[model samples]
Target: MPAQADPEPVTLLLVLEDTETLSSLSDIGEQEGLRVLHAESAQDALAILELEPVDMVLCDALTPGLDGHEVLELIQERWPDCIRLLMTDVSSGLEEALRAIDEGHVYGFIPKPWHEERLRLLLRRSREHLGTQREWMQREMALLEQNQDLIALNAALEQRIEATQQELKQTAEMLDKTYDELLHMHVTTARVIGDLLHHRLPRHLQTNEQVYALVTAFCETHALDHTLQQDLQLAAALYNIGKLTWDDHLLATPSEQLSANERTAYQHYPVSGENHLMAMPQLKRAAKFVRHHRERWNGNGFPDRLEGSDIPYGSRLLGLAVDFIELQRGMVLPREVPRPQALALLRKFAGRIYDPELCHDFVKLCVEKAPDLQTSGKAVISLETSQVKPGMILAQDIYSASGMLLLHEGKRLDQHLMDKLKNFEEIEGRNYTVLVYRP
Candidate 1:
C-alpha cells in the first residue's frame, strides 16, 4: 500500500516594508509548520488575502500606502474571522500598537526583533483557534438540516390526520342515510302486511285503529320519541297477528272468557308476533315491544312477566291501549262497555295490570284530548281528488269507488300520501270523494 502524504500546514500572510525582517520571520514560520506568503506592502497583502485562504495576517505598522491599523481594519471588515496581528518596530511606537488593539483591528502585537520561539507559539495558537471555529460551523449546519427535516415530517403528518378526519365524516353520513332508507322500507312492509291482515279480519282492524289512536295520544303526552311512536303504531296494528294461526272456536271466544288451553294459547301470541317481526332488523325494537306488551305491572302478566320499569316503555303503553280498546269492544266482558266504564276499569287495574303513571296519563288524554281528535267539532269538508291537499286530516275513511279502503279516518296527510292518492286516482280512473279536516 502507498503511504498517505502529510496535509498542508496553515498559511500565514506577512506584510512588511523591511526585507530582512520578512526573511527572518519566513524561516521561523516554516520551522513552526506554517506556510509563509511574503507581501512587501499592505496593498500586496490585501491582494493576496482576496485571492487565497490565509489563517492569519502579520503586518508592520509603518508599511507604505497603508498602515497596520488600515490594513487590519480592512481585513476585519472583509474577512472578519481571519486572525490579524501587528508587528511594531521602535519607529512605530507602543502608541500605534495600543490604538490598533483599542480599535478592535488586531488580535495582539508582536514587537520587532521578535523571538523565534514566541512567534512560533503565537502561530500555533492561531491555527488551533481557526480549527475550533470550523468545527462550530459544521455543527451549526447539521442542526439546521435536522430542523428542516422535523418541519417537513410535521407537515406530512398533519395532512394524513386531516385526510382521516374527512373520511370518518363521510362514513358517518353514509351510515345515517342507509339507516333512514332501511327504516322507511320496514315501515312500508309492516303497513302492507297490516293492510292485508285488516282486509281478512275487519273487526280486528277496527280495534287496531282505536288502539293505535290511544297509543299516539299517550306517546304525545309523555313527549316520547317520534320513531318510537311509529314503532308502537306498527306493533299495535299487528298485535293479534298470531290469532291467524288459531281455530275458529279459539278466535271466536272472548279473551276474558277463554278456557285454560285457549288462554295459554292466547298468551303465546305475543311471542309469535315477536317471531314474525324479528326477521327484520329495522323492526327489532318493535318486536321487543310486541313480545312484552302483555306483561303486567306487578310481574303477574305473562311470557317474560317483567315488572315495572324492566318492561320496555313501548310495551307498557301498548298494554294500556289494548285493554282500553278491548273493554270498549265488549271483548273483555260479556256486554259492550261504555267509554266511561272502560276508563273506570283502566283506573281500577292501573297498578296491577298497567303502569300506574301511564294509565293515569291515558285516562286524562281520553277524557280531555280525545274529544279534540274527534271530527264532531273540527271543520270536516268533502273534497274531490283535485281539491285534496297536504296537512289535512282524513275525517272519514277514504275508499275507492269499488269500496276498497284507501286510507283510514283521522290519519294525517303529507305530500307522499297525497301523491299516492292522486296517483291511484289518475291510474285507476276511479274518482275519490275524500272527507278531510280543513287545515
Candidate 2:
C-alpha cells in the first residue's frame, strides 16, 4: 500500500540518563516485537537519530546536560513523523510534566520508576498504529502501480488497431485487382468459343462477329451497367454454341428449310448452350441470358417460352442482337435479307416477337451505328493471303471461309497476324479474300 515513504521499521529510542533503567525498558520493547535502542543522555539520543530512523521516543524529564522535554521538542523540529514521550519522578513538578506534553507534543508521560505492564501496553499500542499505517500506505502504492500498467496497455492497443486498418486496406485493393483480371479472362474465353464455331462450319455462313459488334456498341451507347454489359456480350457470342454438337447437314441447312426431325433438334439448341455455360462459375449470369434469348413477347418461344416480363431484360437484348445479325446472314429465312429489310422484319413483329419498348431503342441504334452493314462507305482493295502485308489496315472484317471474324474491321495487320492468316489458310486447304484500305 505504500512506499515512496521510506519503509522504516517500528523502532523505539529510550533516553533514560541511567544505564540500568535503559536495559530493562529495552527488554520490554523487544517482547512487544519492536526494534529498541536506548541512550543515556540527550547527546546520545540525538546522535542515534542522526545514524538511523526511530518511530517512538521515551525520555526522562531530567536528561543529562538537557531537559527531556527539550530533547523531545528538538526531535519534533527535526523529525516530525517520530512519536515523543517523557518520564519523570514525584520531585519533578507535575505541572511542568503536563506542560511538556502540550509544548513538546509528547504522546504521554511515564513515572520515575516505570511499571513493566504500562511500558508493555504503550509498546503494543505503538506497534498496532505502525502496522495500520503500513497497510494503508501499501494499498496506495498498489493503486499507483495498476495505473501505470493501464497506461502501457492503452498504448499497445492503439498500435494494434492502426496495423489492422492497414491490413484491411491492402486486402481490399488485392481483391479489386483480382476481379479485373478475372473479367478479362472471361471475355477472352468467350471469344475463343466463337472462333471454334468458325472452324467447325468450314463453308457455312455465321453472324457471330456482327452480333458481338452490335451488342457491344449498344451497351456502350446506352451506358448499361457493367454486369448487364458483360452478360449480354458473352450471350451474344456464345448463344449458338449448341449448334457445335449438331451434324454438318443440320447446321448447314437454314431454319425454314429444315425437316421436322431436324427442326425438333434445332429448337433445343438454346438450352444446350445454357448447359455448356453453366459449368463455368464466371458465366453464370450470361447463362441465364442464353437460355431465354428466344423467348417471344407473346407466349410462344422455344426452350422456355417465358413471355412478357418473365423474360429477363438482358435476354431480351441478346435476342434482338442475335436476330438482327442472323436475319441478314440468312440463318432465319430461306434467303438472306438486306440490313434494312431485316430491320423491317423486327419492327413488323415487335410487340409479339420482342419487347416492344426495347425493340424501338434497338432498331434506332442499328440504323444509326451500323453504317457499314455491307462495308459500303470505304474504298477497298482485295488481296490474296500471300499479298497481305504488315501495317496495312483491314477495310472490312476478316473472315474465315466459313464466316468467322478472325480480325475485326480497322485492325492494322502485323507480321504475327499475317503469319496467322497464312497458317490458317494452310490448315483449311483453301484461299480467301483479304480486303484492306487502299494505301
Candidate 3:
C-alpha cells in the first residue's frame, strides 16, 4: 500500500440564516476542500471565529437581528484579513452590499442563488492569498526569534552573565542567515521582473544594429570606463521598470492623453522601479540609475530636479538611449518620427534637454559607424567565429540557420579558434551578428 497523503486543511466560516442555504453551501464547501463552520446568528459566528482560524467569511444578507452587513462590520474590525462575501436575496439590498464594500470590508458579494463555479473560484483565490499571507507571517515569526536572541544577548552582557560571548556569536550567526535569505529573495524577485520586461518588449530591438553601434561608439568616444558601459546597458533595458506598477491602460497611452488621476499614478513608476531594484544591495547602484533616468540636463525634470553634472553619468546615458528608442518607436504620441528627424530633434534640444557633450558624442558615433551599423536585412543565423572577439557580449543565443545552438557565452573562443568556427558552412552565410549584453 502507498503512503497516505495528508489532507489539506480547510478553514472557512459560513454564517447563513436560512437552513437550505446552509445545507447547499456546506456541501459545496466540503467538495472544494474547505472545513466549513456553520453559524445561525452573528453571536454564534463571532464565537466560532474566536475559536478557529478562518480564511474567509460567507454571510447571508437576509439574516434576522445582526444582519450580514453588521456581522461583516464586526468581522472587519476583528479579522480584517478574512475575505468577506455576502449572499443577497433582494435587489434593493445593494445598498448594504455597497456599505459592505465601502465600509464593511467585503472582498466580493454573490447573489443568493449563487453559481457553484463562482464560489469555487473565490475560494481558490482566497486560499492562494492566505498562503502568501502565511509566508509573510512565517518571516515575521523569524524576526521575532531574532529579537528574542538580541534581548538575551543584551541581558547577558549587562548582567555579567556566563556564556555571554557564546550568546552573542549565536545571535550574530542567526542574523547573518536571515540576511542571506532576504538577499536571495530580493535577487530572485528582481530577476523575475527583468525576465518579464524582456519577454514583453519588442523583438525588433534585437535586430537594430544602429542602437548597439551608436551606444558602443559613444562609450568609446567619451572614454567611458567599462563599469559605466555595463551600467548603460542595464539601465537601457530596465529604464521602464517603474512602468510595471502602472496600469496597462495608462502605460499604453501617451503621457498627454492620461487623465489627472492617471497622471499622478504614472509618476509613481520611477520610485516603484527604484525601490524594486534597491531591495538587493548587489543591484543598489543599478537602482540609482532608474531613479535619475528621467532627469534632463537642464533644471526641469520629474521626481527630482537635478540638472547637468548633478545628474548621474550612467542615468544621462540611459536617458539619451531611451529617448532615442521612444522617438524611433513613436511612443510619444501622434506618430513615430523617422531616425534622421529624431536625431535632428535631439540636436535641437541638446543643451537644454540632454548633456551637450554627450549628445555631440552620440551623434558623432552614429555618423561614423553608419557603415558597420548597416544590417544585411537577413535574419542572422549564427555568429561568425571571426566576429566572436573579446570584450564583445553575446546579445542572444547563437544558433545556426538550421536552429542548432552554437557557442554559449562565458565560453572563450579567442581569434584563431573563432576563425576556424567561422569557416563552417552554417556560419559562413551570416555576417558578424549583433552582440547583446546578458547581465
**Once superposed on the true structure, which residue ranges of model 2 sit more than 4 Å away at CA?**
1-166, 202-204, 371-439
Whose lDDT is greatest here?
Answer: 2
Kindly give the number of clashing pairs for every candidate: 0, 5, 1
Ranking by lDDT: 2, 1, 3
Model 2: lDDT to the true structure: 0.80
lDDT of 1 at 399: 58
Q: Per-residue lDDT of 1-439 in model 3, one digit per residue for the tens? A: 9999684485788888778879988988889888888989888989899988888889888666698888888888899888788888646777768776786478778775688898788778778877787778889999999999999988878777556767888999999888666655554454456656545545542212333345555777678876666555444445577776555566556666678998777766767878877766666676888788778889787669889999988777767766776675656644655555566677898999899998887665543343223344322223344545555544333445554556553354466546655665444575434333422
- TM-score, each model? 0.58, 0.51, 0.40
lDDT of 3 at 309: 95
lDDT of each: 0.79, 0.80, 0.68
Pitting candidate 1 against candidate 3, the one with the higher TM-score is: 1
- Please provide, for model 1 over 1-439, each residue's C-alpha lDDT reduced to its tens digit, 9 standing for 90 to 100: 9999675468889998789888988888888778889999888998999899987898888889988888989999999988898888745567878887887888777887677777777777777877787778779889889888888988998998999989998999999788767766666666667666555554742466677667866777778887897788778777777666777666556788998988999999999989988887767888899899999999998899899999999999888888877776766776666555677789999898889998888877765455223544565565776787778887756656554677887798888888889888897887766667766
Q: How would you encode candidate 2's per-residue C-alpha lDDT over 1-439 as one tens digit per residue?
A: 6759655568899898678888888888888777889888999999999999998998888899788878988999998778887888846556777887677567677776778888777777766776776677788789888888888888888888888888988998988788867776777789788778878664437677777777887898899998788888788778889888898788777788999999899888988998999999888888889889989999699877789999999888889988887786778788876555677789998999999999999987765455224344444566786898889987656566555668877899999998898888898897756667767
* Model 1, position 285: C-alpha lDDT score: 85
Model 3 residue 19 CA deviation (Å) reads 99
Candidate 3's displacement at residue 57, Å, is: 99
